[model samples]
Target chain A: MTNLPLSVPVAPNRLSLSKFARRSPSAAIGAALVVLILLVALFAPWIAPYDPIAQDIANRLMPPSAAHWFGTDSFGRDLLSRLIYGTRPTLMLLAIVILLTTPVGIAIGIVAGFYGGMVERILMRITDIAMAFPKLVLALAFVAVLGAGLVNGALALALTAWPAYARQTRSETVSLRKSDYLAAAEMMGITGPRLLFGHVLPLVLPGAIVRMALDLGGIILIAAGLGFLGLGVRPPTPEWGAMVADGTQVIFDQWWVAATPGAAILLTSFAFNLLSDGLRDLMDPRNG
Target chain B: MSLVDISDLNVTFRDQDVGRHILRGITVAIEEGETFGLLGPSGCGKSTLLRVIAGLNRDWHGSMSLLGEAVAPRRRFTGKLRRQVQMVFQDPYASLHPRHRIGRALREPLVVNGLDNPDKRVTEALAEVGFGPDVASRYPHQLSGGQRQRIAIARALLLRPKLLLLDEPTSALDMSVQAEILNLLVTLKARFGMSFVLVSHDPDVIGHMCDRAARMAEGRIAATFDRPALAAGAAAAR
Candidate 1:
């Protein structure tokens, strides 16, 4: 009595790159762009034609030419070199913010959802309070309190970032908590941390990762905002936001300085947005 | 001592200001190695009763004993009590973790219980469920409905549970696949020498599998049936 459509042909578990590219070309292009940026950041020192900090006053404000591509800053430092070096801090802040936020958010969310009672009330209230505040304002407050630097700016962003993830994951976990698979797990005596980490975490991770990717563009903007506000990494580090700040003074005469770093920021943000959209499509069960 | 003895079981769910009673004063005893069936229509607390026995519904007020040990309300099943009880859920597609491979899903109980030879047990489970070792690497979605149900059964049986609770286990399946799964359960029950508390709306299923049966309605056991009565009822329904 094996009636019900006996064994539908199984699809391969892994998605081939060619198939992914074909399915979501925008994501593919985004991925390629992001990879290129990473490579540029990774090899900044070697790839940059001149010392980013070494100023040549004679060539000051020289526009884009054979001798200097992307022209020179007020200090006559290579704009190309500065832009390349700027990628390091931007990428690092992104890494730090994600690393700090995701686990903390996921843990709080899971614990609250799985154990729903006073625990859920307290955790969700805290999340609500955190979310109620404007994220930029909260980050600004945190940076002001902690003092300005790369780690401090990242910390400030991290403090404001986790609540979104917590709320997202909490909602997901709440629904998953009522799922039959979880009920089956409870029957198997897999309670407490094992159930939370093993059963719940894996199921919730795709949503979290997609959210993280989507949030990356916002994170880059916020980090740049912090840098522009004079609360980011110290000057002469060639941060994109700080360079933009530097370029604003001579923007009327030599607009390339501000525009170059501004373009880099925009491209990075666009890449993340495209990648997140592609990932969302890829992870959607309907698409599958 | 009975394998499962429950008396005066009352399960109430409070939703804000409303209190809904799901199972009211359920009393039943399942003997060792006996296949007892709870036959009922939808909304009759049969599945809730099953969940109570499996320790998934801890909010019930009742006296329950499994394997001669009294179980407390709001307390988790642990050690021997936990290992001896397992449940096959209604939906095969929803019961098994979609992300987990068959081998890992089957082996998890063994690993969590700190049992030895998980790989060996997992292999044996696959074989017992009529699956090849290659099936171990497959995800739940890759399998047919019957195949997934078999895997769910395999996962439940890996612990060698003495009392296996089935909550409309084949209700989600097609007629033919349902029969296949029902027969698989019968064979597995015999092989493992385990007691079963089967819940189903079908009298045919109740008569075919259960040694004794109870007809329940609106959270109450309205009638109990002996084997002959069950058979007669099933025949009449047919």
Candidate 2:
């Protein structure tokens, strides 16, 4: 190698959490809410003052008071305890759906994008058909055929949700396929799997992650919707949506039972949505 | 013996219908260690020809031989061919992977070519391109236009290719940076003793760096000229 000046000692900026929080306080807040929810879910047995499913027929449908902070449900189950325990199944379903869908969708998208023409046409058309169906309706139909359970509900939701990731990632891959860096890589005799995993995947992944983050809240809501419809996790389980569904019966007489779970769902879902927005802003290079 | 010998090269968008010809029966030759310039306007197939030599466009009717060996269009380039030829793209901004550090970008070619000790090679190559160890850690976006181009060149040279195919390497840069890059390329060429097929629209660039030059128009080589020994004489006199 020819000699040239080693003039500069570069110290590039490191991305620290505090820096990120300062840049996007909304994301920070969202993350804090999510962490709080996770902590409550993890420590539900310890944190919850009462057993979620222990029926006290005498205390049934009581209004909010210090003795019963969120009052009692129609079944006389503690509303606060049930709300805390409910976070577990909601988050569990979300985790399962994400695990099942993200890889499947990303794989399909990469294949469709890398090999255009007949493969792309066929894959995209299938995705289009899947995407056209209302996600909840499609999940309901799947549950109708498969029978109702947490696993079935998760499977159904994953099946319906995968198309969004597939379509989004496919479009991302399609655009990046024509990238000059890829063309440069091709010229350097870097083709096939190495080119795909090393080059294309890295470029396509951040966008997919942003989309996944945005979709997380929707996934949680859908899981809850499935539970509320009596198609998720079965009865006797202390799930938020099921709790809300149970409380809906005595609406005017006692609002605390339904309101507690409903508020929990609203707050958590809102936190997720805000987190996604914050994440989008944080990850976006243009924002920086 | 010619380093690049392409003959009767005919590239069309569609072979079935005699579709629009991109390169029409074009031929060119360059000697080993010679700086050959392709002077042409935009969309005149100059870049296409360079791409063909770089083994990017395979759908073409041509007999292409580098260092006197025929190349098959659809086949993977042989290891020797890969190591013997490298290209510096026109747009420096778009050429380097946006997500990768300059060091990784330089190392990839060596790794792909199965070269041993890539870390040492990359460090040495970085220095050759007027970059320090710190530059290696920096992403392409962090660097200036000229620095990015230098990284691209460093990436090309990591494999120590016998021939460098440069497509408008300096045209995108400011006029000041253009001269610096031109000088860098000329110096590197002397040190490496590698041939270059430089494509540019600027005649001054052609006159400054090239030993022999050719003008291209509408997918054909319109004319060829020999400069007075790498323009050193003319540049000095000016």
Candidate 3:
């Protein structure tokens, strides 16, 4: 006769701030940068020193000074003001691509993988066709047909970006569907949506999150590239890429004009990349 | 009147390259509240037979009935069958969903079957399996092998099923853990008075827990050891 109740109490699932900070320092740094950038993007109007499009002809192409920190572009529009406002469209492009692509891709992938055979063949073939072309070239072509603008460019990027997510989610769903726990859940009467959402989705979602994080840097770069190519926002909108392209006319004489916006793009892209790197390490078990 | 009856059951996997026969013309009957053991070597179809009875594998030709209801092997299990028959998988690590906490895992069957008081039931089930209240909040990875096994058993018992189909339940644990799990199973069996069709390659496990045991070879029942013969054989082997 042995004592039977073998249960032991444990501390609840709460991570102390210091412990979290210590464990994922890189992720913390990445998160801080992302948050700071988001804040700047959100508070552009309130924080910007001058009207972005307001021209001061006398101060044209002035080097970095107290009155005009990033100096003034060829048109004499305040360069710092333009760059601050430019964060809006850049962040908006990220939001649109993520909002449109993530859910659509995840849905198609999960559905195809869960109900393999005919459904998988149909969905994967469509994805393959989308993925066959160089993503930037495909988006460029799409924007050309749709007529160039920020909306068309964003849509093109979204079209190219969704397939990656679908492919990722499909592979994840395929593996998760084969796990014994899924079989057990199915046997216990957990079927259809409940099985897919409850048992399968939870396991696959972390991988998707990590993938989304990794894709952020690339998507941001592509959006800026589209802007630089004149396929994004029309002139006088103060878009960073457009501003940089405008400054290229007097490149040798007014180096600061192009260099300011170019540096902004580099810094923003780096912030996203660092954040993605930290997310990959934190979210992906293989990396961790 | 037997609690479970299966006659001339056959199972095969139809692969594009090769069709492999798994279970061939197997027949067995188990009474209510009886502990039935299936002893065999690997690829002997003992586990397959247990799965069929649990209604997990439906792609088979079989006439089977459990607790007076005809057992149908379909992708989805009927709620009545779900409430009456539950299964415990061999690999404790793989049996429970890795992402789910112990509490959620235990509550799932109850919620699926529309049983009331999941909060109370989860606590009771954990206590019945000799688990502490705090164990529910922890993931499977947080617990030891034996503790996970106990959680799996606790999960099965949450539904208060009449028959538990266990496939090599203790084979994955250490010798000490194995003994403790086996003892726990024995204690729980007596307490609940539910039927068990325990499948294992270990003969000593069969001799210890089962009142009547069958030996399977190549998808067929090769021999059976009744209660008295099993006791005598244990003595003789010792």
Q: In order, what lDDT does every prediction score?
A: 0.89, 0.84, 0.83
Question: Per-residue CA lDDT of candidate 3, range B128-226, in tens?
Answer: 877767778888877777888988888888778899888999999999989988888888988988899999888888888888988888999988878
Q: Which is the better candidate, 2 or 3, if ranked by lDDT?
A: 2
DockQ score of each predicted structure, in the order shown: 0.51, 0.51, 0.47
What are the per-residue Cα lDDT tens digits for candidate 3 across A1-288?
333543544545465556656777866777777888899899999999999988889889888899999889987889999999999888888898888888888888898999899999999999999778787898899889988887787888888788988899999999877677887786667788888888888877887887888788888788888888998888788888888888899899989888888888887777777767766665563322
Please give, for residues A219-270, the per-residue lDDT of candidate 2 as tens digits.
8888889889999887788888888888889888898788889899898988
lDDT of 2 by residue, B49-132 (tens): 988888877778879898777897866666788777889989999999988888888888888888899898988888888776
Error of 1 at A193 (Å): 1.6
TM-score of 2: 0.93
Instruction: Report the CAPRI category for model 3.
Output: acceptable
Q: Please, what are the lDDT tens digits per residue for candidate 1 over residues A188-260?
A: 7788899999999988888999999999999999989988988899988889999999999999999998999
lDDT of 3: 0.83
Q: For model 2, what is the alpha-carbon lDDT of residue A158? A: 83
- The local lDDT score (0 to 100) that residue A268 gets in candidate 1 is 100
Rank by lDDT, descending? 1, 2, 3
